[model samples]
Target: MGGTNCPTCGTQLMDGGKIAGRRDPGAQDVSICRGCAEILVLTRSAQGLTLRPTSATEYLELPEDAQSLLRVAHLLVRRQQRLVRAPRQLH
Candidate 1:
């Protein structure tokens, strides 16, 4: 994984390196758009790997555990985003 842009928000996501206990992303792997927090799926083409917005039905078809994990991950991303956007306080 090198880099890809979020299809929804066009946020450039860069993969620094492979995480522990995680395999490289392949076709149909689900991803979250860090910019808009939208659910995306990986699609491979002659050009390279890219993201596409996940359909409602496609999301519903995931296992319950997977759905739960996605929800939590989404929350975490949103929380981090909010923290970054929050104004700093001076002592």
Candidate 2:
């Protein structure tokens, strides 16, 4: 997986970079496209996963209201990571 390339940007993930909307941790990951700087979703089925640029392109054009939800989710996740890094001191 370390040598895997981003489905969206086609950039090689040197150190096993994880992508958003990914169900699995690293074994099966979705990555943000460096070329477009947007999250890339892969089509999964019996054939296996494949990048559908049309879908990703459409998602990027979603209305602000729909896109805002993603922003908040990312913000919350970031906040959680920060909290995990900094332990609260008990008085």
Candidate 3:
């Protein structure tokens, strides 16, 4: 497996020129881009896995619970990014 770039933000979703994450991702697996919080899916090709934005229809097909989880995850990623950009000052 090789590093895949997020199609939406073009952020490199790998580390040290290799895939880096909790586990190896497979084709059709949904992922949220850290750069833009765009929901995406992995696509496999002769080269390697690539990220593509998840379509609205594809998202709707997911179970309600799964969809909710993805939304929450996206929000959390955005929140973390905001925190990193602007840390709160001590009172």
Model 2 Cα RMSD, 1 decimal:
11.8
Report backbone clashes per prediction: 0, 0, 0
Question: For model 3, how does the per-residue alpha-carbon lDDT over 3-75 read when each residue is reduced to its tens digit?
Answer: 4777755787776544424256765577677776777777666777777788888888877887887788777
The whole-model C-alpha lDDT of candidate 3 against the native structure comes to 0.67
After superposing candidate 2 on the true structure, give the runs of residues whose Cα lies further than 4 Å from its correct spot. 1-4, 12-21, 25-31, 34-36, 54-57, 60-66, 69-91
Write down the lDDT of every candidate, Cα atoms only. 0.64, 0.45, 0.67
**1-91, model 1: which lDDT tens digit per residue?**
3437776566776546421112477655777766666777776667767677777788888888877777777777777777455321111
Q: TM-score, each model?
A: 0.70, 0.35, 0.70
Q: Which prediction has the highest TM-score against the true structure?
A: 1
Order the candidates by TM-score, highest first.
1, 3, 2
Model 3 poorest 10 in a row by lDDT: 82-91
- Per-residue C-alpha lDDT of model 2 across residues 1-91, encoded as one tens digit per residue: 3223555446553334333445444333334444334344444555555553435445567666655664455345446544343321211
Worst 10 residues of 2 by lDDT: 82-91
TM-score of 1: 0.70
